[model samples]
Target: MALDIYPAIDLKEGRAVRLFKGDMQSATIYGEALEFAKMFEDMGAKWLHIVDLDGAFAGIPQNLKCIEEILRTTHLQIQIGGGIRDEERIKLYVDMGVSRIILGSIATKNWEFVKTMARSYPVAVGIDARNGKVATQGWAKESDMYSGALAEKFVGSAVQAIICTDINRDGALSGINISFTQDIASRSGIYTIASGGFASSGELKILDENPYISGVIIGKAFYEGKINLKEAFALFEK
Candidate 1:
């Protein structure tokens, strides 16, 4: 299968921010949300991945307007996660034209909602983990669930993709945790998207070689200029 490289535009309080290991207090905004999305699209990116950091942490969407602005500004495929707990919010984003909605917290606590959304929309599940175990409540808190087991829960459902992040490696600019991702993908049947610790094009190249890794989300590396989006797209684009 061909791999897709998604440049991430994570918004917090209507601005771009890359949090350290999902820590809300450690966030710092980079730029206005809409402008960033426009720039990313202008860079030849076919898909953009955004997350509502405030909404994910608060358990209530606080960046809906910003999310909407991004959706309106770009014609690229947009996949978003954070604070998408109920069916209505899921419907709202899908109705608002988001290509995919990522289910995180609700994927563990209210799996039925996850299954329902996956069945109804082009839904993706984000399994954020710290040391091999899943974390919830916006990744501020840890959970007892394992990533593989979590993926298994939706095996019979319409879950089309899974985004697995190695939390400890996030925003640290260390490198992509390939072994961890390979483990998750090898154990699951659905498409797996790797996030966190993606520091350079070399790391992405490594993931591109894996048949199970359908996409890679590069956040800090993209914004920090450590990774080039156009080059990545050239290498992975179908």
Candidate 2:
């Protein structure tokens, strides 16, 4: 199967940034968010993964204007998450031309609501895990629920995908937690996208060989020039 690539553009205070281990204080601004969206589009990316970092921490959509600008300007299919806690906000993003909306913190608190939304829209559950435990409220609060256990809840639902991130490896550029990601994929029985700590084409090849992993979110590695977006995309082309 051809592995899908989602070039990421995490927004912080209206600027594109990368955070270390989901730390708000460790944000390294890349540039204007819109520019990064365009750059990803130029690199032959079919999808763009965007996160409202400010919104994730605030529990409210804070970077509406920035998000709107990218939606209006870029043609890449967008999947966005962060601070989307209500049906109204979900509707708002859908109306704004977003292809999909990811529910992070809310998935841990009210997965039933997530299942309901999945019936009507393209919804993906963002399971950001730290040490096998699920973390919510922007990775600040660790829940007692195990990551695989949470994923098992949506075993047979309308939910489109499970975006599982290993908090410890995120933004560190060490390596991707393939075993952890595969575990989620096995439990959820849903399309799973791996996020965090993707540093090279080697990792991409590893994911391509796994049938359960549908895609990956490229963050710090892409920003730090550790991976070439075009070259990574070319791997599955052969």
Candidate 3:
């Protein structure tokens, strides 16, 4: 299978950001959010992942206009998450040309809703976890259920992929926990996209060779200049 790279553009108050270990207060702003989209597209990114951090906590999407701008200006295939709770919000984003909508809080709170969504629309589930337990509400709350068990629930359904992220490694500029990601992909028998703590071009090549890993959502690495965007595209795209 081919490995896709989703250059992440996490928005907070209309600016792009990267938070340390999923902490809401630990955001490090990095200029305009739209610029990131343009830069990623210029560097040959095939897909983009956007998160509405403010909306994730406020129980509603806060960066709709900013997200809309990115969509309007760029031809990048986009998948968005964070505070996506209701069907109306889903319709709003889909109608605006989003390729896929991710189910996060709803994946844990209302599993039946996720299953129903998988049946109808192109969908993915954000399986953000810390030390084996799934984290919800933008990683502010922890759940008793493990991430793998949650992935198993979507088996044989329309759920397209599991965006598995390890909160402990998130934005730490450290390498990703490949074993944790591997476990989820193997156990669930689903296309697993690894997120959090991804750094360097070496890791990109490694992810590409792994048959189970379908993609990786990289943020801090790209913004920090640890992974050259052009080099990443050449390696993963090849």
Cα-based lDDT for every prediction? 0.84, 0.90, 0.89
TM-score of each: 0.95, 0.97, 0.97
In model 2, the clashing pairs are: none
User: Model 1: per-residue lDDT, tens digit, 116-148?
Assistant: 778778899898999989998788788888887
Per residue, candidate 3 scores C-alpha lDDT tens digits across 1-238 of 2678899989999999999999988999999999989999999997999999998888788999999999999999999998999888888889999999998989988888988987878888999999999999889999999988888787777788889999999999788889889988888788899999998877877888888898999999988989888777876675
The TM-score of predicted model 3 comes to 0.97
Q: Considering only N, C-alpha and C atoms within 3 Å, which residue pairs clash in candidate 1? A: 175-197
* 54 Cα displacement, candidate 2 (Å): 0.4
Which stretches in model 3 have alpha-carbon errors above 4 Å? none
**Ranking according to TM-score, highest score first:** 2, 3, 1
lDDT of 3 at 132: 91
Report the lDDT of model 3 for residue 120.
79
Model 1 misplaced stretches (Cα beyond 4 Å): none
The deviation in Å at residue 64 for candidate 1 is 1.5
| Candidate 2 residue-wise lDDT, 125-175, digit = tens | 999999999999889999999999999999899999999999999999988
